[model samples]
Target: MTQAPKADSAALSTDTANADGTADSGAETGTAAPPRPTPIRGYFERPLFDAEAIRGLQRVGVIDVGSNSVRMVVFDGAARSPAYFYNEKLLCGLGRGLAETGLLNPEGRVRALNAINRFSILAEEMDLTSLTMVATAAVREATDGEAFKTEVEMATGIEMRIIDGEEEARLSAQGVLLGWPGARGLVCDIGGSSMELGEVADNTVGRRATSPLGPFRLQQIKGGKKGLKNHIRETLTELRDKVGGDHKALYLVGGSWRALARLDMERRGYPLTVLHEYEMTPKSIRKTIDWLQDQDLSKLRNRTGTSAERMSLVPLATVVLRQLLHVFRPKRVYVSSYGIREGILFEQMPDDLRACDPLIEASRHLEEASARTPGFGRKLFDFLMPLYRNAPPDRMRLIRAACLLHDVNWRAHPDYRSESCFDTATRANLGGMDHKSRVYLGLALMNRYKNPGSNSRLTPLLSLLDPEDIRHANMLGRAMRFGAMLSVKGPNAAAEMRYYPKKEVLELILDPDRQALFGEVAQQRFSALAKSLGVSTKLRVARTAKLEVAKAELANGEAAKAETSS
Candidate 1:
C-alpha cells in the first residue's frame, strides 16, 4: 500500500486568526489550527505533530473502493481526527456475486470502474497531491482481482491497494482507535464478502481474525438458519480463542451495522440520531436483533428511512450480531461512522498529530472560521478563569472548549442558534468525548445563548447529567454571555473579574475608558453571572495609574526637601 504524505490533521478550516484579534472571513477550510497543548494543572500534555508536516500538503484525499460502495473522501488539513472536506459514495455492489461465482458482479464492476474514473478526474480537478486508493474484500476474493486492479490503474492512472483480510482488520481496528483513543475491546467490521474481528487495547492493535460471515456470503450458505448458525459458530472459534468470552466492549464498523443501529434508534424513538459513538448494552442490542426477526422489514425500512438493499442484509447481519453478543457477552457495543477512510487518514498522521486533542482542535477550528473575534475565545476563557479556578483538569478543558466555541454559531439564524449550538457540540464528528460529555457541552452551549426551559427537547439527553453538571454548565454559559458582551471591543477591552470567595463578592472592574460600553444589557448579564456564582456583584471603575504615579512623585519631592533642610 502506498503511503500518502502525512497531512497534519490540524484544523483545515481557513479561519485565520488575524493580528487585530479578529477572525478573518476566508473560505471555510474544513480544518482548524489546534490549540497549543498547555499542561493543565494536575495533568500531562503531549506535543502535537510539527507544523512542517502539514505545511506543503494541507489537504489529503482517499478513494475507498469497497465491495458495497465505491467512495471518495477528501480530508482537509490534518489532525488526530478526520475533518471531511468532501465525501461521496456510490452503492455499487462490486462484491454482489463473489459468493456464488467467485467473481465481481459484471454489472457492478462496470459501475465501480466508471465511478473510479470519475473519482480520478475529480481528484485531478481538485489537485489532491496526496491521494491514495484502497480496495477491500470483494476485490481481494475475486478470481480476476489482479486483472481488475491492472485495468483500474491503466484507465485511471492510480494504483489501487488491494488489502487482504488481516490488514483490513488491522485498519478497521485503527479506525476505532482513531475515534476512541481509549477503546479497549473488540472491533467487528462487517463487509459484503467477509467480517473481520480484531482486539485493541491501551491504544494498540491486538489479535485479529477474519471470517466468511458477511451477509452476502451468508445468503449463499448451503443451509438456512441452522446452517448459518453452525457456520457462524464454527468460524468464530478462532476469534473466541483469541478474544475469549469476556465482557469487553465491542466497536462496530460497517454500513450494515450502522443501518441496524439506526433501525434500533427508530424502534426506540431515540432522540439523538448521531450514529458515531452511539452505544447499546448487550441486552438492548439482543432485544433489538430478536425483535427485528419478526418485524415487517419493508415497513421497518420506511420507518427507519434505510435503503431496501441495506435492510435486506440486516437480518443476516442481525444473526451474526446476536451470536456475537452471545459469544462475546460484550459490556457495550459502540458504532463507529469512521472505518477504512478514517483509518487511512490515521495511518498518515504523525505520532504528534495522532496525540492532538480532537474536541479542542475542532472547537478552535470553528472559532477561527466563524467567530466575530477569533482570539477572544482565549480572552473569554481567561476572563472567566476565576470562576473555574478549582475546576478539575477535564472540566477545565471542556470549559476552554466551550469558551472557544461560544460564538461560532452566531451565524446561525437568531431563532435557531441555541439549538444549533447544542447540536453542533453534541453531533459533530468530535473525538475523545463520551455521550455524557457530549451532552454536557451541548447543554452548556445551549445555556450560553439562552436559559434552557424545563420542557426543552434537549431534556432527554440531560438524563446523562446531574444537577451539579447542569449548574456548572449554566455558570460557564453565564460567564460566557457576560464575557462575550464585554469583549465586543476585543479581549483587552473586557473588564477584569475579581472573585473574593470569603466575601462572596464577584467584582467587575472596568477600564475607565471602556465604562460607557458597559450599559444596561451588560449589567443584566453581569447580574446573571453573579447569580450563577451565588455571589453579590460589584461594578467599579478602575483607578488610573497616572494619579498614583503623580502622588508618589510629590511625596518623593517632599522627602528630598526635608532631607536638605535637616
Candidate 2:
C-alpha cells in the first residue's frame, strides 16, 4: 500500500500566493515576514496529548467505507476522548446487491466515489495531509474490490486499506475498549454485508470471528423467514463455538445496532437521549424487538428521526439480534457509539495514554477551557477528600470527575447554571460513563449551584440513582458549593477543611490572613454542608504556628476544661 506523504511545514505557513499561483517570497518583496505565533496544543488549548504519542499531530481524520454507508470523521482534542471536529456520512449502500452479484453495486459505487471525493476535498481544506481509510466486508469480499480501490486512489489520491474480517472484528472491539477500558464482553458489530463477533476482556481483544450474517446477505437467502432464521442460528452457533459463550455482556456496535438501541429507548420512554453507554437487559431487548414488529415503522422512523436507509435495515438486523440473544444468552446488552473509526485512533495510542480514564481526561479538558481557575479542580478534590475517605475506587473516580467539571458551567446565566451543569454532565461526549454515573455526576453539579428541590425539572433522572447515591451526590455538591466560596483563587487558598466523622463535627480552619474571605454567604454555605452531613459546624482561626500544634493546643484545652468541671 502506498502511504500518503507527511504534512509539509510550508503548507501551513501564513505566506500568500500571487494570482499566477507563484509564492510572494520575502526576498522579492525586500522585507522580512513577521514571526509566527506558537500554536496552542490539545483541544481548546489544553495540552492533553503527549507530543511524542501522536507524532506531534494536532488532528487526524479517518474514512470508513462500510457496506451501508461511507463516513469521514476528523478527530480533534484529547486522543482518549477525542471530539468529533468534523463528521459527514452518506448512505451509499455499497453492498446492497453484493450477495447476488460478486461485484459492488453499480449505483452504490458511484455514490461512494462521490462521497469519498467530497471527503478528500474537505480534508484538504481542513489541512489534513492524509486520511486513514478502511474498507470493510463489502469491498474486501467483492470481485472488483481491488479495482474499485485503484479507482478511488486515481480519483481522490487517497489509498484505501481493505482490512480482513478478523482485523475488522478486532478493531471494532478495540473501539469499545476505547470508551470502556475495563469492558469485558462479546462485541457484536453488524454491517450491511457481514456481522463480526469479538471477545473483549481485561482491556484487550480476545478471540474474534466473522460471519455472513449481515442483513443484506440474509435477504438473499431462499425460503423466506424460516430459511433466514435457520441460517442465522447455524451461523451464530459456529461463532459462539469459535469465540466462546462466557461473555456476560454484549456490546453492540455499528449503525444497525445503534438504530435498534434508539428504538428500544423510544419504546421505553427513557428520558435521557444520549445513546453512548445506554444499557439494555435481555428481557427488555426481547420486549422491544417484539414490539417493533407491530409498530408502523415509517411513523416510528419519523418520530425517532432515523434515516430511511438505516431504518430499512433494522428489521433484518433485529432478527439477527433476536437469534443472538437466544444463542448467546448474555446477561446485559450495551450500545457503543464508538466503532472501527475510534478503534483506529485507539490503535495509535501509546500504552500509557490508553491507561488514562477517558472521563477524567475529558473533564480536565473542559475545566481548562472554561473554568474560572484552571487548576482549582484538583485543589477542590483535595479539600473534599475528608468527606470521601473510604469511598470505593469507582466512586472515587466519579468524585474526581465531578470536581474537575464543577465550575466549567459558571458562564451560563445565574438562573439556569444549575440546569446547564446537569445537562452538560448527562449529555456531554465523555466516555467511560454509564447512565447512572451520568445522573450522579449531574446531580452533584446541579447542587453546586443551588439546592435541588423535589419539584425540580430534572427529578425524573433521579430515578436512576438509589437513595444512597442521591445523598452522596448532595453532600459532594454542598461540599463544592462551600469550598468555592472560600476563594476566587482556589479552595486551598482560603481555608483547610477537617471532618471528624466520629465526633459529628465539620471543622473549617480559616487562614489568619484570609479571614476576610469568610463572609456571610460562606458561613451559610458552610452550615448547609454541615447540615447535609448531620454534623455540627466548627469554625476556628488558624494560628501562625503549625496546624498540628494548633490542633494539639485545642485538644489539651478541651481535656483540661473537662477535668476541672468533673
Report each candidate's C-alpha RMSD, comma-separated, in the order given: 10.0, 13.5
Give model 2's TM-score versus the native structure. Answer: 0.88
Record all residue pairs in model 2 with backbone atoms less than 3 Å apart, i.e. clashing: none
Please count the clashing residue pairs in each candidate, in the order shown: 13, 0
TM-scores vs. true structure, each candidate: 0.85, 0.88
lDDT of model 2 at position 71: 92
lDDT of 2 by residue, 102-208 (tens): 88999999999999999888888887634578899999999999999999989887778887788888888888887877778898888999988888876788888
TM-score of 1: 0.85
True lDDT of residue 537, candidate 1: 88
* lDDT (Cα, 0-100) at 37 in candidate 2: 15
Off by over 4 Å in 1: 1-50, 243-247, 455-464, 489-493, 500-504, 538-566
Q: After superposition, how far is residue 212 of candidate 1 from its true place, in Å?
A: 1.4
- Best model number under lDDT: 2
Instruction: Tell me the tens digit of each residue's lDDT in model 1 across 1-566.
Output: 22253332221111110000000000001222111233322211211322566544466778888888889988776666567778888889998978889999899899999999998888888878578788888999999888899999999878788877777787778777776666777888898888888787766677777788888888888887899888887777667896566637787888888888888777677667777777777777777887887889999888877888888888889888888877788777777777767776677666655656666766777776789876567767777888888888678878988988898898899888999999888877666666667777888888888997888878887766778888888888888887888746443354678898789999987777667778898889989888988999887877867434534554575466457546
